[model samples]
Target: MTTAFITHHDCGLHNMGPEHPESPIRLLAIQKVLQKTGLIEQLKQMESVHVTPEQIQLAHANLHQKRLEMKQPDEGVVYADEDTALCPDSLHAASLAAGSSILATNQVLSDKVDNAFCAVRPPGHHAEHNAAMGFCFYNNVAIGAMHALQQPNVNRVAVVDFDVHHCNGTVDIFKDKPEVLVCSTFQHPYYPERYCDIQRDNIVNCPIEAHTRASVFREQLEKYWLPAIQNHKPDIIFISAGFDAHHEDPMADLNLTEEDYRWATQLLMDAARTTCGGRIVSVLEGGYNPVSLAFSVQAHLEVMAGY
Candidate 1:
C-alpha cells in the first residue's frame, strides 16, 4: 500500500498572527510543494478527525485540557504564553492536528499503509504534560505514541525528534516511562531550555551548538540515536520531524539542507523497517521559512513514500 498523507483544512485556520513564525502558510507551502513535486498524488490522502478530549487526556493531564478549553477565544487571539496563542478556531484546528497523528498511527499499525505523515499542526512537541508553551498546545506525537501503545502487540514505541529545538515537552511527558524511548536532537542554550540535562536512559537528547552543519548532525545521529533505537527495537517509530534547522531557514543557525531531511527520513525508515514492519508515523513540528520548509517537507515525504 501507499503511504498515508493525513491532514485537515482546520490546521490552516489556526493562525497565530500575521507576523508569527508558525503561520498557516506553513501548511500551504508544504501542500504546494508536494503538488509541485508530484508527491501529493502518489500517497493515500485522508482528512483528519477531530481529536476527542479523551484521546488528548491519554498524554496530558485533565487540567491541561480544561485550561486549553477555557483559554479559547471567540473572536480574537488569546495568548497561552508569549509565544503560544488561541484564536476562535485554534482549538478545533489543534484537535484536528492531534487527531491527524492518531489516525495516521491507526493506518500504519493496521497495515492499511506502508507508513504515514501528519501534515497538520500547532506543532506539539513543546507542550508539557500540564502546560502549553513554545507555540504548541497539545503534544500530538506524544498523544499518538500513547494511542499506538493501546494496540495489541505494541508494547514499546520510539519517538525520534529532529526539530532544531529540543522537544522539552516530549521528554517531560515520557521521561518516567521506560516503554517510550525519546531520541531528540536540538540546539543547546536555545528556546525552552529545560529537561536537556535530565539523566534518563530512555530519553536521549543531542544538543548541538549554533552553526552546526549536516556533517555534525549525521555524526551525532549515528553516535546517539542509532544505538538507542537499535537497542529499543520499538514496536513502532514516531518522528517529530522539524525542518527549522535548514540552512535557509530563518529560525535557527544549524545549517541543514533538503538532502539532510531525506537522509534522516531514510535513516529512521531503515530503523523502522528492521524493528517494526516499517511502521512509521511522522508529525510536523517546526519549519518557518515557507520556501525552504516546502522543499524540506517534500524531501522528507519523498523518502517516507519510498523515493
Candidate 2:
C-alpha cells in the first residue's frame, strides 16, 4: 500500500519566464495542494535520482544530449525555443526532472514502493528524440520507460500519455518497436504536432480537438487506451501524467476536468492491477494554470494511491 512521490528542489529553478505557461510554478501548485489537502501523509516523498548521460541516451540521441549540454547558459537566459529557455540552473533542473522518473521507475521495480509519481517540472512530453521544444529538454518519462524496458528480464512495457500536447518525443523514440506500446491522446493542431504520419501498430495516437470534453475522453479511454494496454499486457506501465488538458488550462483547448484525470488514472490503475501487480510509474509532464493543475494532480494521485 506504499506509494512514492519523487521530486527535487532544483526542478523549481528552471523558469521559462514570468509569462510563459510552463513556468516553474507548475511544481509549486502541486506541492502546495498535496500539503493543504493532507495528502502528504498518505504518500512518501523521495528525492529524485539524478540520471546519467547514458541513462538519458536510452531515449534521446547522443547528439541531442551534446547540444543541450553545450547550450547551457553560463548566466542569463538562452533559448531552446521561443517558449523554452535555459537559465544558469536550467540544466540541473532538467536533470532532476529526468532523474525523478528514473527514481520513480527504480522505486516501483525494486519494491521499495508500490507506485510512484514525479512532481518535478520542465514538462517533457513535447521534446522529440533530437529536438527539444515545447518547454522540454529531455523526454523524462521516455527515459524512464526505456530504463524499465531495457531491464534484462523485462519483456513488455506500455506507456500511456494523456497530455494536452502529444508526446512527439516519446512516440518518435518508441515507434516501430514491438517491445513497447505507446498510447497517447491529446489536443491536435497544437504545439510540436502529432507523429501520426509515422504509422506504427505499437503507437495509438488519438488526437482530439480542442475543448473535447470528459465523456469523449472516457469513451476513448474505454475504446482505445485501456484495450491496447490489456492486449499488450505490459510487464510494466509508464504514464506521462500531464494535466494541461484540464478545462482550466489555457495552454490548450481541451475541456477535461479533474474528474477526467480521476477516471483515466483509475482505468490505468485497474489495468496495472490485472497485468503487472499494480506496477505503474507515473511522471509529471504538463500542467499549467496552477489551480487546475493542483486539482487534477490531486485527483490523479488519489487513484494511483488507491485513495
Candidate 3:
C-alpha cells in the first residue's frame, strides 16, 4: 500500500475555458475527495516536476514540442484546436502534468513506492506525436513508459487506458514498439476516432459500443487486456485513468459507476503484483463531471492504496 501521490498547482492553472469539460475543477474535485475520505493523509505526497524537452521527445516530435511552446499565449488563450487551448500558464501546467507521470514512474520502479496516482490535468492520451488536440498537449503516459524503458532491468512496459475516448496518441507512439504494450478500452465512433482499428500486434484496443455497461467493460478487460498483459509480462504498468465513461459523465455514453473503477484497479493491482512487483503509475486523463469524477477517483485510489 506504499503509494506516492504526485500532483502540482500548475496542473490546475491549465485552464481551457470555464465551460470546458476538462476544466481545472476536475483536479480540485479529486483533491476534495481524497481529503474528505482521509486518503490524502495515508499516502506520500510529492510535487510534480517539469518534464524535460528530451523526455517529451521520447513520445512527441520535436516540431510538436516547439509548437506548443511557441503557441503559449502571453495574455488570453490561444487555440490548439477547437477543443484545446493554451492560456498564459498552459504550457507550464501541461509540462507539470506530463512530469507527474515521469515522477510516478521513477518512484514505483525504484521501489520508493509500490504504486502512484498522478492527479494532474490537461488530459493526455489523445494528442498524437505530432499534434496537440482533445485537450491534450503531450502524451503523458507514453512519455513515462519511454522513461521507464530507459532504466536498467526495465524493458517491457504496458499502458492501459480506460478513457471513454480512444487513446490514439498513446497507441500512435507505441504501436511499432513491441516492448511497450498499449491496451485501451473506449467508446467507438467517438472523438478522435482514428487509430481505433490500427493493425498492430502490441496494441490491443477493446472498443465498447455506446451505452455498454460495467459488466461488458469488465468482460473485455478480462478477455482482451488480461491475456495481452500476461503475455507481455511488463516490467511496469501505466494507466491512463480516465473516468469520463461514467453514466453520470456528459462526455460519453458508457454506464460505469465508481465501483467499476475500483474493480478495474483491483484487477490491475493483482496483475501487477504477479507480473511487475506491483509497479503502477496512473495518470489522470479525462473525467468531466466533478462529483462523479471525485468519487470515481476516490474509489480508484482506495484500491491503489490497497484499502
Which segments of candidate 1 are over 4 A away from where they belong?
Answer: none
Model 1: weakest 10-residue lDDT segment is: 1-10
TM-score, cand. 2 vs. native = 0.97
Q: Write the per-residue lDDT of candidate 3 for residues 1-307, one digit (tens) a residue.
A: 7889999987888887778778888888889888988999998999999999999998999888888889898998999999999999998998999999999998988889999999998888998889998999999999999999999999899999999999999988888899999999999888888899998999999999998767999999999999999999999999999999999999889999999999999999999988998899999999989999999999998999878
Residue-level lDDT tens digits of model 2 in 37-127: 9997899988886779999899888888789878888888899888789888887888889998888888888888889999987878778
Report the Cα lDDT for residue 81, model 1. 95
* Predicted candidate 1 versus true structure: per-residue lDDT over 1-307, tens digit per residue: 4799999988999987899999999999999888987899999999999888988999999888888889898898999999998999898899999999999999998899999999998999999999999999999999999999999999999999999999999999999999999999898879889999999999998999998767999998889999899999999999999999998889888999999889989999988889988999999999999999999988888898887
Q: Which residue pairs does candidate 2 place in steric collision? A: 211-253
By TM-score, the better pick of 1 and 2 is 1
Distance (Å) between predicted and true CA of 165, model 2? 0.6
